[model samples]
Target: MENSVIKFHHCEKDIYCFFVPEQCPVCGESLSSRRLQEAPVSIPSPFVNGQKIKCSFLVKPTKGTFLREYDGRSDLHVGITNTKGVVYNYNETGVCRDEQGWAQSVSVPLVQPDMYSLINQWDPYLEQFSLAEMWNPQRYNETDHNCYTYALTFINCVLATQGKRNLTKTEFTEKFVLPRTKKASRYITLYQEISENYFYIVDSSQQEDDNSSI
Candidate 1:
């Protein structure tokens, strides 16, 4: 596949594409791209590992040819891929109807930790969902399904409040270091200093003269 030229289908949506490697392209973090493809049902990396942002929404089949069927199961699975390249999966059950189509839905979630802060900025009382269903199994049986109605939108908002979004090492230290030092105060003396280009921490064992900038 590496040697083969890749093609993308034109999407009206502004899509961000990434070329994932054997390891995290950023932060030099070790990753297993191979494992994802090899799994019986491939679970994307961001979902299983460190910090990921996610959101889910439902989709109803309104027009023609909006539904699909699988060979073995009476149910269907709703899945989505986020900007960070993680995939979220939900299993749904549905039944076919005589008319007005089947009431089916898909929950679409995105993995964007920064979005939580932005969402709160928009609405303080917005409902937060913990787990979401992406597909309906009732309408997924033998016949064609259409005109689905999605119930909710769930997003993982915890990551944002926990300060897991985009951050530099310096910024992270400034935001989280003080509290850590305070909590460890009983065990050791933690002195800290920050300058325009230097930041350092001193232990109780360090002599005053030994404490100096890098």
Candidate 2:
């Protein structure tokens, strides 16, 4: 499959292409080389041991009228990704409605070095919290139980592991509220602040200082 080549159909023209697999292993859909074409990509398995892992907070836009008109937000989805590059979010399957659709729109990396360690440590806790419901489509709710809440919960877990304070509901709203709402400016500002504070790489010296103090 790795050596196979694919030809793209673009504007009624066939173009030679290479590198990508001929078909998706999971969905068995034909792969296309066209820039506009969307196809599913495989997610690599998670690392088995406590190796260095990077997690990113992601936001994906929604195209549904019900989502936009009713929710009043273009930022429809939120999720997290590890170094293996698999996104974990709460949403319906095929939410993107495209072959290659997954949270590819916007992303911000977590700042802490022990992010993966915390994830491994919190596995049992998450399970008890009904982590399986995250994958259940029927359990999704727009207000009380949504992708935003899922992401915020995960972030809070990570923060707890670091001895950091948890974000309140109001604070979470201010930081990640839908951009189309009346608090657009405040949302933008708080989003920038959280992104910069929680997503950037920490200095080695600072990290050492933190660890030593702890």
User: Which candidate ranks first by lDDT, i.e. highest?
Assistant: 2
What are the models' TM-scores?
0.18, 0.42
What is candidate 1's local distance difference test score? 0.28
Candidate 1: regions farther than 4 A off: 1-3, 6-77, 80-86, 92-214
Please give the range of 10 consecutive residues that has the lowest summed lDDT in model 1: 1-10
> Residue by residue across 1-214, what tens digits does model 1's lDDT show?
0111111111111111222344432234453534332321221211121113223322322232122331222333232223332333332333221222223332234334566555443222222121322235543333333211222121324345555564443553355433432332321111111111121223323423554211
Please, what is the whole-model Cα lDDT of each candidate in the order they appear?
0.28, 0.46
Count of backbone collisions within predicted model 2: 1
The true-versus-predicted C-alpha distance at residue 122 of model 1, in Å, is: 14
